[model samples]
Target chain A: MSPVLRAFLIISALLLLAPLLFPSVYYYRIGVLVLINTLSVTGMVVLLGYVGLVSLGHAGFFAIGAYATAVLPAYGIPPILTILVGAIGAALVAAFIGKPILRLKGHYLAIATLGFGMLVWMVLSKEAWLTGGPDGMVVESIDVKAPFELLGIKIKTAIAWYWICAVAVVIGIVLATNLANSPAGRAMRAVHESDVAAASLGIDVARTKLTAFIISAVYASVAGSLLALFNRYVTPDTADFLHSIEIMTMTVLGGASSVYGALIGALILTSLPQMLTVFAEYENMMFGAIMILTMVLMRQGLAPAIAQLFSRGRK
Target chain B: MSEFVQFCFSGLTVGAIYASVALGFTLIYNASGVINFSQGEFVVIGGMTTAVLIASGVPIWLAAPIAIIAAVIAGMTLYKLAIEPARGAPLVTLIIITIGASIFLRGLMQTVFDKQIHRYEGFSGEQSIAIFGAALLPQSIWILGGSLVVFVLLVWFLSRTKAGNAIRATSSDILAAKLAGINTNSTMMLAFALSAATGALAGVLATPVTFTSYDAGVLMALKGFAAMMLGGVGSPAGALIGGILIGLIEAFTAGYISSDYKDAAAFLVIFLVLFFMPGGLFGMVRVERV
Candidate 1:
C-alpha cells in the first residue's frame, strides 16, 4: 500500500477505536474539538508548511464560517447549506484580500493580515443588528442522526458530533495529502524556497499562493461552522487576535511541515487544558514558555524533532 | 467648530501617546531588524509600576523614575533571554519569540499585580482647561508636552551622543560597524533599553487619562504599529507624523462616523495607503539584491 493510504488507515483505526476509552460525554466533546482543530491545522500545514506563507488572519475566516451558520439559518437558509456558504464566502474574501496583502513580505505581511483580522473582529462585535453584537447568537444544529436512525443505530449528540467531525477530518486529511503530492504542491514548495526562483522556473507564484490562501480559509471556515453547530452558539471571540495566535501556535508547535504533526498539535492543545485545570492561572506563562522553547530549541517542531531523535537512536 | 477643536485636542493627546510608542518601535527596528512585539508590554510595565507605587503612598516624583527603570530592565531581560538566543533567526521565528515574551510579561504582571484597571491622579491635577467650548484635561497637555520632550531628547541623543552614533552605525551596516570596533550586541541591548524607556514614559503620562490594565498593551502595540506603518517603517519623523495622523483620523471617525468603527477606519486607511505607496509616506523603497 502507498504511504498515504497506510497513514490514512492508521489514523482511521485510531479514530474508530479511541472512543472505547471515553468514560463520559465530556471527553467526546473534547474529541470533537480536537477533530475540528485538526481539520483547521491541516490547512495551516498546507499554507505555512508547504507554501511558507504566514497568515495571522485565518480566524477571520473561521468567524465568517461561524457567523454564517448562526445568522444564515434565520434567513430561511438550510443548516447544511450554511457551511458551504461560509466556506465559499471565506474563500472569496481570502482571494480578494490575498492578492494585494500577499505582495508584502515578512513583518509587513504579518501586520497586514493582522489588520484584516482585526477589521473582521471589530465588525462582528459592533454590528449588533446583524451579528447580535458581542453577546453572540445561537447556531442552528444540523440533523446528523437521521441517516443513522435508518440503520437502527442511535447515538448521543456529542458522540454524533464526534463521528461526523471524524469523518470530515479523515476526508480533509486525504484531500490535503493528495494536494501535498500534486504538481501544484511542488509549485508551492518551490515558491516557499524562493518565489523569484519559482517565478523564473515558469511557475505562477501569485496564483499558487492565492490557491493556498483560499484553501486554508475554506478549511478554517468549515471547522468554525462545525464548532458552531456542535456548540449551538457562536461569538466574535472566535475571530479575535488571540484565537489567531492560538491557531498559529498550534501549527508551529505540532510541526508545520507534517500532516500528522498538525494532528498531534491539535490533540495536545485541545486536550491539555482539560487535564491541566489546576494550572489554569499559569496557562499563559506556560504557553509563552512553550512557544519560546519550541522556536529556540527545536525550530522544526515536535514531531520532526522526535522523528530525528528516533532515527538517531536506531543508527 | 468648537466640536472640531475638541476632537482635535483629544486627537493630539492620544496621538502623542501613539507617537512615543511608535518611536519605541523605530529604535528597535533600526538597531535590529526585528519588530519588537513586546513594545507595548513595556508601556504596561511603566504604567502598572507607577500606579502600584503611587497607591502604596509613594510620591509621583519617586514612582515615575522607578517605573521607567523597571521597564528598562524588563526590556534588557527580554533581549538577553529570548532575542539573543535566537540571533539570526528568521523573521517568523523572531516574531514568535517576541510575542512569547509579551505573553510571558503579561502573565507575570497579572500574577504580580491584580487584573484590575489602574490609574493615579494626573500630575497637574484634574482641572479641565476650556478651549473653544471644549473641556480639555490638564493631563492631556502633560502627555503632549512629555512626548515632545522625549522626541527632542531622542533626536539630540541620536545625532550628538557617542553611544547613539554607535547604534546608528551598527543599524546602517553591522559588518562595517564591527570592523570599526563598534559592539553590535551592546548596541542592540541599548536600543531595547531606550525603546522600553520611551514606551514606559508614554504609559506613565497617558495612564491618568487612559487608565491601563495588564491587557492594555496589545491594543497599544497594534495602534502603534499602525502608526509606524502609516508614517514609514524606519523613519523617526515618519513615526511622529504617522501616529498623529492615525489619532486624528480615529478621533474624526469616532466623531463623524460610527464610534464603533473608529479602529476599522484607521486600518482601512492603512490598507489604502499601502496599496498606493508600498513603502509608506517617508520610507525608502527597498531593492532586493537577489
Candidate 2:
C-alpha cells in the first residue's frame, strides 16, 4: 500500500483499538483532544516542518476559526457551515498577512507572527460585544445523535466526538501526506532548503510560501472549530501567546519532518500533563528543558530520535 | 497642558526602563545572535531578590547591588547551560531554546518566590517634585539618571575599551574575530553578563513603580523586543530611541484613546515599521548569502 493509504490504515486501527483497550469515557474525551491537537499539528508541519518557516502566532488563526463558529450562528448561518466559513476566513487572512510577513527571514518572521497573534488576542479579549470579552462565549454544541440514530447505533457524546475527531485527523493526515508527495510539496521542500536557490530554479518562492501558510491556517482554523464545538465554549485564551507556543512546541517536539511524528507529538504533550500531575508546577520549566534538550540532543524530535535508536539497535 | 506634561514624564520614565531592557536585548543579539527571551526574567530576578532582601532587613544600598549581581549570575548561567550547549542551532531552534529558558526561569521563580507581587522602596523617597506643573516622583528622577549613566558608560565601554572592541569584532564576524585571536567565548560571556546587568537594573528601578511578579517577564520581554525592533535590531542608539518612542506612543494612546488598547499601539507600530521599513529606523538592511 502507498504511504498515504498505510497512514490512513494505521490511524483507523488506532482509533478502533484504543476505545476497546481503555473502555473509559474519560479516555475518549482525552482522545478527542489529542485528535484535535493532532489535526492542528498536522497543519503546523506544513509550514514549520516542511517549508522551514516559523510562526509564533498560529493561535490567531485557530481563534478565528473558533470565533467564527461562535459568532456566525447568530446571523442565521447554521453551526456546521461555520466550519467552512472559519477555514475560508482564516485562509483569506493568512494570504493577506502572509504577503509582507513571509518576505522577511527567520527571526523577523517570528516577531511579525508574534505581533499578529498579540493583535488577535487583544481584539478577542477587548471586543466584549463581539467575543463576549474575557469571560468567553458559549458555542452551540455539535449534535451527532441524528446520524448515529439513523444508523441504529447509540453512542455517548464523548465517544461520538472521539470518532468525529479521529475521522478529522485521518482526513487531515491523508491530505497532508498527499500534499507532501505532490509537485507543490517538492517546491516547498526546495524553498525550505534555500528560497534563493528555489527561485533561481524557476520556483515562485513567495507564492509557494504563501500557499503553505494559507493551507496551514485552514488546518488550524478547522481544528479550532472542532475544539469549540466539542467544548461548547470559546475564549480569547484560544489565541493567547501561550497556546500558540504550545502548538509550536508540539510541532517541533513531534518531529517537524514527518506527519506521524506530529501526531505522536500532539498525543504525548496533551497526555503528558494528565499523567504527571505531581509535576504540574514544573510544567513550564519542563517544557523549556525538554525543548532545549530536544534541540541539543535530538534535533529531529522524539519520533525521529526513537526511530534512529531503533534502527541503530537493529543494525 | 499639565496633562500632556504628566504623560510625557510618565512616558519618559517608562521609556527609560524599556530602553534599558532593549539595550539588554541588543547586547545579547549582537554578540551571540540569540534574542535572549529570558532577558526580562533577569529584571524580575533582580527586583524580586531585592524585595526579598530588603524585607529580610538588608540595607537598601547593599540589597540593590546584590540583586543586580544575582541577575548577572542568572544571565551567565542561562548562556552557559542552555545557549552555549546548543551553539550553531538554527535561528528558530535558538529562539525556542531561549523561550524555553524563559519559561523554565519563570517556573523556577514561581516555585521559589510564590506568585505574589513584590517591590521595594525606590532609591529615593516617594516625594513628588513639580516640573512644568506636573508632579514627578523622585524615583522617576533616579530612573532617568540611572538609565542615562548606564547608556553613557556602555557607549564608552563599547568605543574605548579593548574588550568592547572584541565584542564589536565578534558581532561583526565571529570567525574573523577568532582568527584575529580574540577570545570570542569571553566576549560572548561579557555580552550576556552586560545584558543581564542592564535588564536587572531596569527591573530594580521600575519595580518600585510597576511592581514585580514571576509572570511579569514575558510582557517586559515582548515590550523590549518590540522596542528593539522599532529602533533597529542591533543598534544601541536604536534600542534607546525605539524604546522611548514606544513609551511615548503608548502614553499618548492611553491619554487620548482607550487605555485598554495601549499595548496594542506598540505592536501596531512594530507591524507598520516591519512592513514599511524592515531595516527599522537605524538598522541597515541585512543581505543573506545563499
Cα lDDT computed for each candidate against the true fold: 0.88, 0.87
Docking class of 1: medium
Q: On a 0 to 100 scale, what is the lDDT of residue B105 in model 1?
A: 83
True-structure RMSD, every candidate: 1.7, 1.7
lDDT of 1 by residue, A234-279 (tens): 8899998777777777888998887887788888877898788844
Candidate 1 segments whose C-alpha is farther than 4 A from its true place = A1-3, A310-315
Q: Which ten residues in a row have the lowest lDDT in candidate 2 chain B?
A: B265-274
What tens digits encode model 2's per-residue C-alpha lDDT throughout A57-138? 8999999999999999999889999999999999999998888888887776777777788889989999999999999999
Question: How close is every model to the real structure, measured as TM-score?
Answer: 0.96, 0.96
| Docking quality (DockQ) for each candidate | 0.63, 0.69
TM-score of chain A of each: 0.95, 0.96
- Kindly give the stretch of ten consecutive residues in candidate 1 chain B with the minimal lDDT sum: B265-274
